[model samples]
Structures are given as structure tokens and as C-alpha cells.
Target: MSSKGSHSGWTRRRLLGRSVLAGAAVAAPSIVKGAQPTFAQTLSISALGKAKIDWQQFKGEDITVAVIPAGYFNNLIDVAGAFEDLSGVKVRFEKIPPGQIRQKILLDLSSKTGTYATHAADPMYYPLYVTNKWVEPLDAYLNDPKISDPGWFDYDDILEGWRSACSIEGKPYGIPFDGEATVQVYRKDVYEKAGIKPAQTLEQFVANAAKVHDPANRLWGAALRGFRGAGQNMYIYPSIFRAFGGEWFDPNKKLVVTTEPAVKALEWYVNLLRNYAPPGVENWNWPDIADAFGQGTVAVYIDAHSSAGVINDPQKSKVIGKIGYARWPRGPAGKRVTSIWNWSFPVNAALSERKKKATWLFIQWA
Candidate 1:
């Protein structure tokens, strides 16, 4: 609990900043050897034992990690047995749907139930956690020699934007486990067939989508999230908001959504979806968009770069080699802004000391 950091890496200025990984397909460390994700990429059971820390220090402890049943977290579940074998700690990862998990985690945190020792928390909630001191400042565990090896952990390998989002006032409340940035996804075959080039600006984007908007053939030009959840519509909106040079607040931190750029961006988005995208595009999320693209219905769309992973899976994708990616298009402001997203694990403050340490160990390892 005495954890604090004077290092500039942990600063309040970066709380919840969006980040895009530089040139890496995936942010998490992995050495995969096959098409499907497996434990082969995660840390080897013996490699973890060679670390200086005593992996078995908290043997016989039990900790539960609350997580969504997403690909990133499911990948962790596949390899969790390695940690359990090395440390003798029983880890129960409770996978819940996103909507229900939020309610569960909020209830657990607000009530101080300690039911979940850790969770893949929403970054936006870090400020509230820091304000209420509801989560452990992770600098203690990161710097503690007996518990972690900073060099081996390679915290620096993580993008600064992701690191910043998990920290408030230089105190890290969470450890980033997965991250992605918004990018333009399109079908190479569609573009080649239509002779449409990738859009460089917002106007060009619409034009390009229009050229490929073939409703008669059952192919739509583009898609964007219209669902109302925070991770749904709100998630995709920020990129367009930033691209139009619309900041969330002014100098006095006053909310400013009525500005010219903001309105223009909103109108542009509505028109794009209303005119060119497939039916019920208004209710789509990232998954729906990805699924549509993989099924060869959507000619182009903009979303998290990670969608490539799903669309490239030959097992389920119909456009494996036909898909393409590019940086998000610029808006009237001449700025290209990509939405940064991540999920991180934070230790619950309500847990007992032993359980907290056990949770930290799990965070470090898996």
C-alpha cells in the first residue's frame, strides 16, 4: 500500500490516453508457433521459475480474476495452468459478458466485497479508483524485487499511451494486458474490382465508400459502430471526434460538444452510415462489423486494427487474403486520429494482504 513512484513514466497527465502500438501486430508478448492461439506463446512454466522471485511464496492461496470472455482474455485462460503449476496458487478466472461484468465489478468495488481479487478493468474508471483508493497502486509490486523483475517483465515494451491510461498521478492502478488502435479496414478484392483507392481524408472516405457501395450485389460500402454501449458507439466516436479537432473540454475543462467541428463530425458520421452501410448498421458493434467484413458483405470500414486477426482466421473468414488495412483517414481538421483501447488488470483494494499478493503474482505472470 506504500507504493509510489517519482519516475515520470507514471504521471497524471496520461490518465486514460488512447494509444496505438508502433508496427506490432499484437501488443502482448507472445511467441506463438501455430495458427490458433495457445500456451506456446506465453511464458514457459520453467522460465517463470528461473526468475529471481520466489514464485511459491504465496502457495495455497486462492484468487479470482474477473474477465470478459474475449479472445485476449481467453488466450490467457489457455495458459493459466502454467502459473498455477509454478506458484501453487489456485486462480479462478470468472468470465462474464461485458454488460454483466461491468455491473458485477462495480458492485464488487463499491461494496468492497473482495469477491474478485482482480479484473480486466475499464481504463476510464481509473480516476474513480484513484479518487476512492479502491485499487492498489501497482508501483509497489513492479518495483519490489522479491515480487517482480522489472527487466524481465519489460514494462517499457508496452506503449507509453497504454501505460499512461492505467496510471493516475504517476501511480499505476492496473497492468495493461491487451491494446489496439483504430484503423481503416477494406477488402482488397472489392477495391481492386471497383478501382477505388483508399481514402486519405473524410470527403475522400465517403467517395471511396460510395464507389464500392453495391447494394444489388449484397455488399455494403462501409460500417461503423452505432450501438449505444460505452465500448460500442462511444468507442468509435472518439476517433472521429479527434479527427475533426474536437476536444472533449476547453481550457477550463468545460465540456464542449457543440462546436462546429463536433457537429460536422456527427453529421458526417450519420450520413455515412445512413447512406452507404448495410441495414441495421445503427445497431452494429465491432464484432458485427468484423463479422460482416469477414463474410464479404462490407467492402470497407474503420475499426480497431486488431480486427485483422479475426478476419484473417481462415477457419471462419471468407476474405483471408482479400482484406487490407490502413491508417484511419483524416478529417476536415487535417488530422488523423486513431482510437486507442486496452484492458488491464487491477488489484482489488478490498482483498486481504495475502490475496492481494497472490493477485499481483497472477497479473505479473499471466
Candidate 2:
């Protein structure tokens, strides 16, 4: 089946052609159908241009990268093998659990430790990295004609409101990778039964959720992360704060999580748990949520797009062909907020310039 959305023009073959061609003209197909490009494959011509790296020059070095477990980019052995085949450098990859990634990074960098030379991280750690000076700055690498593409990695694709999130003061600290945002997922069949369209407001969202929740049929109204640890607390509870016009920190940048809005957001999340979610949901992480949605147990999901590929995987999802997605609901603020990151390969400052260059080359291939 075509992954092409209604609005996109290019398809898988055309996207591949564009990637290979990079710039030269192509003869348009007469009856192109059912093959629009995947979002990841649709790189702007400028991005393809900027991704060029001279792998032949970086021949005799071993490059290692530290990545989070289940990290999609890191797990691409085909890309790594391609890089190794093109360049003689052997790739040493390591996956650290999310709970221990920070400490391990700190130990490696602070001690100028062995073999651990590069990092791939979510930008949420940017604040900590800057305060600790954990990773090297990429300004030199980005400015070097061999590496950075200013136009392709422009502020527009990064989104304006999120610019400050990844930047420290004014310097770009980290590149964004994947992010979690709650897109609306509802049972279109159930909505049709109840005579309601997809919702736009908080009240509407709640009402729709309640309507579709049929316990006799073992269907749940919603599925969300509420594991009570950093992952759940950070992703699921924070949106409620925004819904109530609350900010995590004050204008002066002090932690003010105790405010009324913050409390209300927590309350809303707790209520979601009590009312809409399936039993035993508070213990779920990413897998459980994906499974719940795939099994037809969930009527709604307010979670990350990181699981987009999994939801559509035919082997695992019962609702693979049935799901419909929309943006998160609006609140009084009239603006939407979602998390984003630049999960890029970051070289260590302490490494020699040659090694750093090789690291960037591997990153380009990655």
C-alpha cells in the first residue's frame, strides 16, 4: 500500500530517483500512482547536497557511537555496513539503557574515558549537557564546507517556538531527533455510531472518549503513559499544564511546578487514568501503548509519533488498517506544543580533529 498522504506529490520510486539524482532534472511519469515517498525519504534537494561527506579520506580509524536502546537510527546496520564498505573505518556501536545514559555519558567525557567518543541524544538533555560541558560544540564542524548545510537544517524545519528548547543562550547546542506529541486517535466507527465528529476542544475530547469506551466489548476510551517515572511524568502530565495555561518555569526561569495550573494538569491526568484508560495502564511504557492500540483495545491514544511505524506494521496491529490520526486538541492558549529533538551524532571535543572528522563522516552516512 502507498504511504503517500493525500497532500504529498512524490512516491517511493520518485523519492529514490530524486535522492540519487540530487539535482538534475527527471522525466515525470505519466500515470504515477500509489507510491508517494515516505516522510523520512523526502529530503529537500538542499539536505541531500549538505549530507555529502568524503569517506575515502577517513580510512584507518575506528569510530564508536553511544546511543539509546531501541534507538531507530542507531539500529540501522545496513547504513553502518554501507558506511564501512565505502570507508574502511570499522563501526563500534553501543546501546545504553535510557535510565543510565546520562551518567555513562558524564563518566566517559569527564574522565576523557576510553573508546566512547560520540553521542546521540534527545535535546531534553541539552540543558544538562551545557551546564556540564559534556559534549563538543559543532560550530566548527557545521561551518566546515565538508560537513554542515545551513539551508537544509534551517530554523524553519526545526520550528520557531522549539528553537530555544534546543539552544543554549543563542548557540545551537543539540540537533533534534524524534519527539513525542499527542496526536488524536479515535475510532471513526464508534464516532459515527455516537453521531459525533472528531473533537477540537478538551471537553469534546473527553466526551468523545467516554462515548466510545465500551467495556462490554472490552474497548477502552484511551491509552496513555502513566508509569509514574520520569518518562511518563514528563510526557503525559506536562500537556495538561499547557492546557490550563501553565508553564513549568517562571518568566525568570525558576522552577514553579507547584502552581495551580500545574496541579490541575496533574489532576486531569489522574482523572484520565481513573476514567478513560484501561486497567493496569499506569505500568505501561511504549510497547504496551502500541499493543493496546494495535489490538483494538484502545479507542484513543494521546502519545508520541515515535510509534508511527509500529502502529502501521501489519504483523502486530489489528487496527493497522483502521487508525486515523489528527493533531492534538486545542486549549484556551490557542497554541499547540509538542516535543522535538535533533537526535544527531555528536562528536566529543576531546577527540583529535581527524577522529572528529571521521565521526562526522560516519554520522553523515548514519
Candidate 3:
């Protein structure tokens, strides 16, 4: 999408052009300075719904982007044209299904198929990416002096947990974008009507869920994701496990799937699903979660904060202004555990020197 008058709020320019690989930047001298871009010069980017992707100059060449359809990012139609305008490289973005995106990329990279020059995958996969050596290191680009707006990334604003996940052995593996943390989303009106404050601990959360749950009146206490797949296994399970004093791996990084915490967390989660959730929650994903919260069928939604935008949007939500946000409830461990969802862009390691240069340039400008 076209962005006018520069990005406001937080601008990151220092990270530009620091560690850029010489060959990657130097190989695309032609695309870099050869032809003047003939794309539309002016596009309205100030208004939320007014932005358009500039497709004039990007009629040819090969480029691809991977994206998931959720959060405010469902507006993927706006990114390509702008990239095409800035670089003559043709843009070919591949949007993947939310549940399948991570596994798809992992499989692609592990097999060395290298279909995309650049792809946007979640930061949660950083551990897998690093382990498999499927992603190219971004330090060169980050350290390059010619790149612009390195600080635009706002590394500090990212949650520390996510930061730790993206980094391995003190080296960063991905450029982070978008943040979704599990927070307590409740019905302010209902809470007031019941004269109950928002819940802040596992004990309090369960009690609150029971209080708000009135299934006979068609209102459930909570909306939980219990679908048995990556969504359930990864997204929904982590928080419960953590709250039950479970860590995915032992101190030595070995899997601890059969630990006491694991059993307790799963038991608690299953109980919530069996008692407090609405019908057919076993099939829910992002949309189902958003719909439940929006339709006011669930009084407390302990899901990602990304749904906040959708629930708060007037055009899409039926209970727009009534939903309120709060810190996640405390667990037995005396800590708040929130699941992390992140999307990030990565470059393919196997591209030709010429293509690599073009890809690096495109990523810098993007």
C-alpha cells in the first residue's frame, strides 16, 4: 500500500544499510539505478481504507510474499503495488492459510525447494527455522549502511518472550512484525451487571467464567480454542501449560510432554471446553473466536489481542464498544502466561547472486 508523508509515531532509520552483503547489494546495479520507476507517483495513504498497492512498474520479474489472513492484516491487497512502485521487481505474493502457513514453510525450506525469494512467516517458527537452517541470516542486511529505517522495526516494543524466541545464541533470525498476546477480553456491560471485577488469577478466572456462564440464556462464560491441530496444539495449549507451571522443555531443552504441569494444564483446558464453551468450539479458529466475542456469546475471551481490532471495528463487530481488555489472569505459578503470535519476512538462502541482490533491495525498501 502507498504510504504518504512518511511513517509517523516510530521511525527507524539507523538500522538501515549496516551489515548489507556487498555482492547482494552490488549485483543489482541495473535494477537499483537503471530505470526511473514509471508507477503512479501519488497515491492517498493517509486514510485507513484509501491506500492502494501501486502495480504500474512491477509488471514483470519474479517476487513472492506469504501472508496469513487475520488481525488487521487481512488487508494484504494493499502491500504489493507499493513495493512494485519502489522497486521494478515484479511482486508475486502467496497468501497461505493460517493453520498451514508455518508447516508449509518449514517443509519447503527443509526440502530446499526455495520457491520464494522472500516470505512472511510467523516469528514463533524462528526456533524451527534456526534449527533447520532454513532461513538466511539477516545480520548483514541489518548492519548495512545503505539500508534505510532499520529502527523502524521497533525491536524494543516487541515482548521480551517473543524477542527471546526469535533470537538464538544472541543472533537474531527474523525481522519482527505484528504482535498478538493473549489477554483477557471481557464484556464490560456484563461484568458491571454482575457486579464482578475482571479476573486476574487462575482461581479468579475460573470463578469469573462460572459466574458469567449462563448457557441456558445462550451466553457462555468463555470462548476457548480446542480444535485439535496446530491451532490447538500450539496457540491454545501453550498458555494453559505455562499457567499450570509447565515449561515446554526441561532445563536442558528436552521435551517434557508428560510432566505434571502438562497433565494439569490439559485437564484444566479440557474442563473449560466441556463445561463453559459454546457448541462446536472443537472446530474453531480465528474467525470463530472473533465471532463468539463479537456476537456476545462469550463473556470472557482469553485469546490474542489481535482480535481486539476486529471486535472493536464498527463495521465488523456487533459488540464493538462493549468489549474491554485486561491483563491475563494469574496462574498457580504466580505469573501471567500469554501465547505469542508474530509475523515476519525472511529471504531465501539459495537465490542466485543477481536475484539475492534484487530481493535484499526489495526487503530494505519494504
- The numbered model that scores best in lDDT is 1
Q: What digit string (tens of lDDT, one per residue) describes model 1 on residues 1-366?
A: 101243222221121111111112232322221122224323345445556788999999988888875566655655566677778888777777665677788889989999999988888789988888889999888888988876456566578899889999877889888888888998988899888888889899999889999999999988999887777788888889888988889999999999998998899999999999999988788878888999999999898887786787666689988877888888888988887888899999999998899889888776
TM-score of each predicted structure versus truth: 0.86, 0.76, 0.77
| Model 1 regions lying over 4 Å from their true place | 1-43
Q: Tell me the whole-model lDDT of each prediction, alpha carbons only.
A: 0.77, 0.61, 0.63
**Model 3, TM vs. native:** 0.77
Q: For model 2, how does the per-residue alpha-carbon lDDT over 1-366 read when each residue is reduced to its tens digit?
A: 011232122232244333433222222222111123334344522234333455567788877777665425433431344455556667776666555665777677777764666776656676676777766666666677665444333323445445556677777655444334567776666677778777676666777878888878989888778676555446655666787778878889998977877776677678877898889988886668877887888887777776765666666677766777777777556655544434545567667778877876665444
**Global CA lDDT of candidate 2, please?**
0.61
Clashes of each: 2, 10, 24
Model 3: lDDT of residue 18: 20
Model 2, residue pairs in steric clash: 11-35, 11-36, 11-37, 175-342, 176-341, 176-342, 176-343, 177-341, 177-342, 177-343
Name the runs in model 3 displaced over 4 angstroms.
Answer: 1-60, 146-161, 231-233
Greater-lDDT candidate between 1 and 2 = 1
